[model samples]
Target: MSTVAIGLLWIFLYDPSNGPINQFTSALGLGQFNWLGDPNLAMVAILIVVIWQFSPFYMILFKAAMVGIPEELYESAKIDGANGWKQFLYITFPSLMPTIVTSSVLAIVGSLKAFDIFFIMTGGGPGNATEILGTYMYSQGFVNFNMGYASTIAAVMFLIAFVCVLIIQFIDYKRKKRGILS
Candidate 1:
């Protein structure tokens, strides 16, 4: 689904008065609370929305990585009496390290560029409570018509994300080198 659609759906669900969330709370005698309007809660609300939207994608990545691991490793571990947790720790985790690093990089970069949900949901409202770099750049470029500043913000975001990827690669390289040395 498009970000606009997801954002609208989340807005409807999180609406303070007649939203299903508030309604459910009221039904449970917890009373109504503004989810997106409150300054303190708006960021939390956005966090929840982002997590809900992306968790399944990450889960699929993890599942694929786990499935790619050869069955022989797990079979040997099981034969050695390694329980589920030990098997996971000794076999699954090491095998998934590359996937985990790749996923982390993707997630970090995607998050740095995230704008749609915040734009549609809050528009950086409630006094910029949930303003992120992407939304801030949009606001600066389009809303304020400060193209120069917006470009600078975009550059900075790119730099930050690039640095993160480079750092991950460096760490992975060092780990590989250490493994070879050992």
Candidate 2:
């Protein structure tokens, strides 16, 4: 589905009054909740939406990486009596370091620039409770017509993402240099 469609679907699913979530809660006797209205719930609601939307991509990445891992290694570990946890710790985790770093970097950068879902769902509403950098920048530039400040916010966002990428790269490099990841 298009981003707009997905956004609208989430809005429908999370509607404070008639959303499926409230219906389910009412059935369970947990009472209805303002999923997208209450300040505390709003952030949690956005978090759930963001995770729901992006987790599949990251899961696919990790799955592909896992598939590419040589089966022989696990077999040998098993023969050596290494438990599943040990095999995962010493073999699977190291083997997937690159993919993990890549996915983490992508998630960080994408989140920094995320705007559409938040905008469509809340428009930074309920008193700015869900205002991320991307939405804040949009509000400043388009809603408030403060282009200069918006540009500054955009630049800062870029810098923060860049720094995160650099940090991930540095850690990956260190791991590889130390032979923790081959």
Candidate 3:
């Protein structure tokens, strides 16, 4: 689903008086608790939204990586009396490391640009609890009409994202050079 749709859906889901979440909690005698309005929970609510939006993509990526793995390794592991857990710890985990690193890079870079859902859900509010670089940059540039500061924020975001990707790539390269790329 689109970010706008997800944001609007979560906003409704977070409605304290009538949202399904609160209603469910109330039914269980947990009482109503505000999801988005509470600063402490607002970031958690956004995190749930982010996870819901991106988890399926990660699943598919990992599935594809698993499918590409040679069957011989697992067969040999089985013959060697490696239990499921050991097979996973030894073969599967190592095999998935590259994909995991790639996913980490993608997640980090994408999170640096997260703005739409945060804007729609909380606007970095309940007292700046959910404020992120993207939201702050937008606020400075548009809401406060401070383009220079916004530009600086954008540059910093770019630099941070670039550095994150570079560092992850360097680590991955080192692992590969050490023959750990499985």
40-133: candidate 2 lDDT, tens digit per residue: 8998898888898888989999999999999999999999999999999989998998898999899999989999989988988779999899
lDDT of 3 at 138: 96
Task: Residues 111-135, candidate 1: write the lDDT tens digits.
Answer: 8999999999999888999999999
Which ranges in model 2 have alpha carbons more than 4 Å from their true place?
none
**What are the lDDT scores of the predictions, listed in order?**
0.92, 0.90, 0.94
Q: Tally clashing residue pairs in candidate 3.
A: 0
Model 3 TM-score on a 0 to 1 scale: 0.96
The lDDT-based order of candidates, best leading, equals: 3, 1, 2
- Provide the lDDT at 125 for model 1: 82
lDDT for model 1, on a 0 to 1 scale? 0.92
Of the candidates shown, which would achieve the greatest lDDT relative to the real structure?
Answer: 3
Q: TM-score ranking from best to worst?
A: 2, 3, 1
* Candidate 2 colliding pairs: none
Candidate number with the higher lDDT (1 or 3): 3
> What TM-score would every model get versus the actual structure?
0.95, 0.96, 0.96
